[model samples]
Target: MNKVTKQNALRAHSWAGVFLSVLLFLVCLSGTIAVFHFEFERWEQPHIQEMESVTPATIEKAMDTFLTQNPQESHHLFVVFPTSDIPRLVVENDHSAYFADQEGNLIEKESVSFTEMLVDLHLYLNLPHSWGMILVSALGAILCTLIITGIVAHKRISRDAFKFRRGGNGQQSQIDLHNRFGLWASPFHMVIAITGVYFGLAMVVMAVVAQVNYGGDRQAVMDQIFTPDPILAPQVGKPEIGKAFAQMQTLAPEKTPLFLTVHEVGAPEQFIEIYAKAPNRMIYAESYRFDTQGNYVGVAGYEFGEWGKQLAWSVYRLHFGDFAGMTSKWLYFVLGIMMTMLCVSGMEIWLSKKGHPVLATRLWYSVVWGSVSALALTAITDMFYSGSLTVVFWCLMVVNTALTVAMKGLSKSVWLMISGISVLGLLVFYLIVHTTASVTIASLQLNIPMAVYVCWSLYRANTLLKRERMAPSAKAQSGSPAQQTPA
Candidate 1:
């Protein structure tokens, strides 16, 4: 392209990047940590021993035992049977629940874990359901814009695509890292962006469609997609969960029951929906329903329905990287980190152009390093504490944010040095503490990769700090007012 065209493209890219970079970085960083939420949940309740399999009889006994303890709440009891990932029977009364061993003894009360809180924060910023998701979806759209403009800005796309210069001028170094990560992670970024948007926009889309096509009754749209027509109301009577469990086993021998949902418990229209894992499918788990009397109803439609319903049902599994197991999770995690880097680097690039303010650099340091530090602290906290993970997480977040705001405009080198040292120290401490926990082999397997990534990030940050300290004039030459101005 000619000089004028190139300049125009750069101008557009710069404007887009400035507008959306911070939001994009937050979304990407949160998403990366959220990948291991289930693992974190397991780590939080280390006392809950793993079991090879939890039988229907075992679950029934647990349910009966739980009912005996809370007789009045038995009608509302719901049990989530343990899976390979989490190996304890989890039983709940309306507002509270506890994990139990295979023999039905209570282990731990229902308390949110730090990692799960991070996932919630990442997806919805811990906002109330209504507004939080709307904000998240808006961020997703901004991410799309960043991706589009980033591609446009790189003029010699193919030649510099895979290049990563180890030692170069500062701008060249930034550009190389940017191009390398952005190109290698392009497909992964696209998948995450689309899926993220889908999640954020799903409610909005449903609302619009409901308003336009279903006269604003969103439940009608949802029912058409998710629920099956009610079979003729059965005679009102006491329901037997045991019989329903037995009948489900027979109807779906190949599938395993995930959970059972009892609707309108005491009424004649009350029915049980048993969500079961598809025996040999990568899609979402299927549902099999039965009446209160335990008579088989019919299969839910999404598992055997039209294209749109199937596609919609599959989004959670697809977006969350839970569909294909370990390989998919790792791929998602790595890509998530790259996306996070894209966000961080995008912000840095903008700041670099307009003069890297000390405050801006410090904020970046706190966000990038503080995130890693928070995660490490959270994992360590889970290994010991029994209170509320959510409380601990918010406390850590508040402390980190406060520290960042306070430290802003200080020496960038000092902030980087301190953050780097803290991250490295935390990683070592976590590894030592974590080794003493009664972690299952499965949990360890998942955590090992995460540990490696954390160490590498720490090392990288430390190395960057060391180099920055050795070159005082480099900061001055970069034209940042904070570096050039006299005290």
Candidate 2:
């Protein structure tokens, strides 16, 4: 490549990295944590009574009881049969679902999980409707730019493809680590960037298309894309849920129905749409429709369609790694951590540049370290506190950011130490509490994984701190006149 081109590419990469690093770090970290969201749900409500077998009869009875309780509501009902992982028959009456005991007695209301909340934050930063998605999309675009420029900037891409120079000067070492990770993980990084952008930008693009082509009716676009034929009004018959469910079972025997929605319930025009799980597919779920009287209608088709719409439909599974089971989740988790590190190291690169001021360093440290500390604190708070997880998360974010900003230039090492200590202590305390108390096996199983992870993080942080402390002393000792002369 030409010198001028190389220089320009390097400059572009450095600027883009500086601009998007913090946001990307936040997104990646949250995405990594969100990989185990369902497991966390199981963790949160271990006391709920569980059953080995869930029959249609049990679910039907539970639904009947739930419907009777909320008789005033005129909407569809849903009953989630218990599974091996989560062994509670959950019944919903429009607003929310509640877990039931073995005898169909109401146990407790299911609350929003912390991991799910984090997933939402990762995707939208918890902003209102479409706006948050747009912002996240913009970040994705920035990431794309960063990736393209980063590739172009590396002139000796081949030679340095697998090179990781250890124990070099700090700048050289950082550069090597950055390049090594970027090279090795290029494909994974591309997948994450594209999928992440697809998720974030989907709504914006849909909204625009809807506005331009469908007179600003987004629902109209969705209907055209997803829904099948509208069921006709039944002349003189009542809807039969059991018959409709049976038809669905016959048609899609391999897949189980996750939920069913009856549009215009109790009306002659009402139709039952059953959303069934696809064991090994990229599409979110295959939907089947039936009339009020449980007559088989049709299946919603996305397989044979315009590439753009088909691509958009597939993005959700690709982005979340939900199409694949635990193996894919683990792959995404590892890639996510690498991506998070890329963001952090990118920022460090910018800070290491000549003529960069102390203020920039302080800001970078506060943002990076503050976010880490905030996440650790959030996990701790979720485990101990019970009131409102959403409230506690926001409060922790506010407090961490404020502290970081306020304490800038006052020894980042000290803050890091305190964060490490707090995380370690909380994890140890949680482990002790869980072990000592008479909790269910399910709860213990969930808590143990998190406890082990926290302990590992604590040990890692402690080791790094020790090495950092010893570095200056070793450097001073090596640089001494007598030692230098002898060497």
Candidate 3:
């Protein structure tokens, strides 16, 4: 591109990043944490019975017992089988859920408010699903635009790949970090952007395609894209859950059953669908269908299916880095953190370029760090309060931001100190509430890392405080404007 073209691309990139900064940051932060949604869910109910496996008969008994207890909840039913990730059998309907013990007895009602809130923030921003999803997907498209323009704008991106200039006006360091992270993570960014858009926009895209090729028959489009629903005659009390489970074992022995859904529950036409995860494959799952009588129907074709269908099915795992067990999850978590930092540094670059206006800088800092503190505070709130946690989180976020701004922007160290304390408070409160029952692998998985972060944050904040305390004295001893540090 020409110099003028490059300059225009730079402007476009900057404007796009500025527009999406806060929402994008929240999305990235929540998504990074949401990689362990299953773990968090398990941690929330540590006292529940967790078994490695449950028989088909046991699952059937549990379902039957659930139906007998709550006859009104017959719209639809589901059984989420235990997996290596979450070894707890979950049976739920539209409104309520319960855990099944080894003996096929319903134990406690499932509750994972904090995990649900975290995942919802990432998925729908706590808005109604339909509109929230579309907005988030649109942001994904804009991220693609920013990615392309960013690459075009940096004419010497390759040459400056490893360059790092510190101890300057701070702009250079921010710019360098932004460029470095963007460059290093470009491939991952592009993959995430494309997959992210697919979730919400897929329906719209399918609709348009149906309009053009199938005379706007949306069902035809769905049938073409996905496996068609099985037609069945009405006449049923309950689906043959055990029979379908056995059929699944015989049919796809290689794939592991993740969950089973009973469609049109208690109706004559009700059928069972089991989603089984294929080993060493990325498609979300290969589904097997059966009629209410336990008669085999057909497969969903995500595995060994059309390339397009397989690609579409694989989006969730690919985007969230859910493959390869904990290794991939950790990788995604670290890269997600880097992506979140990229958003922050991009805004910092804009602020630096604008001469670091005090109000703007303070507001941005309040938003960035205040968000971290808010999440910690909200998690603490969840331990004692059982009300609307989504409301609590956002309210805390606003309160944190307003408090910071009212104080005319506390120093970075102060924010860090607050965040560290909030996190420590959350952990301490959790320990107090659960006491000895809180000690579990799932709980420790999250708590240990949180405890480590508290230590790191406090240590870093103290070091920064010391540096800030000494800076004025050092400048006074020199007694020169040139000796003063750049903002």
TM-score of 2: 0.85
Task: Tell me which of candidates 1 and 3 scores higher on TM-score.
Answer: 3
- Candidate 2 residue 179 Cα shift, in angstroms, is 1.9
How many residue pairs in model 1 have overlapping backbones? 0
Clashing pairs in 3: 235-268
| Better lDDT candidate (1, 3) | 3
1-487: candidate 3 lDDT, tens digit per residue: 8999999999999998998899998888898899999888988877777888789899999988887777774568999999988999988888788999998999988989999999999988989999999988988898899889989999798799999899856788888899998999989988888888998799999899989999999999888668887887774766888889988768988888999999887676788999999999999998999888788888877899989888888999999998889999999888888889989999988988889888778778778777778888888888889999999998988887777768963877888888899889988988898787578887898999999989998999899889879989977878877876888
lDDT of 3 at 275: 95
- In terms of lDDT, model 1 sits at 0.70
Q: Listing every candidate in turn, what is its Cα RMSD in Å to the true structure after a full C-alpha superposition?
A: 4.8, 3.6, 2.5
lDDT per model vs. reference: 0.70, 0.70, 0.87
lDDT score at residue 387, model 1, on the 0-100 scale: 79
RMSD of 3: 2.5
Residue-level lDDT for 56 in candidate 3? 86
lDDT of 2 by residue, 1-487 (tens): 7888889988988887777677777777887777767656766665567777555455556666777676766656666655543556787766777887777667678864666568777888767647787777778777777777888889899888877766755777888888877777877777778887777676777899999999999998877666645757562344555577667667988875666676666666678777776666677667778787778888776544566556767877677676666677778778877778888887787777755466667566666666666666666676667766556667776776566567653344545555566656655655665554415766665556555655665676577667768989999999888778652
For model 3 the local lDDT of residue 151 reads 92
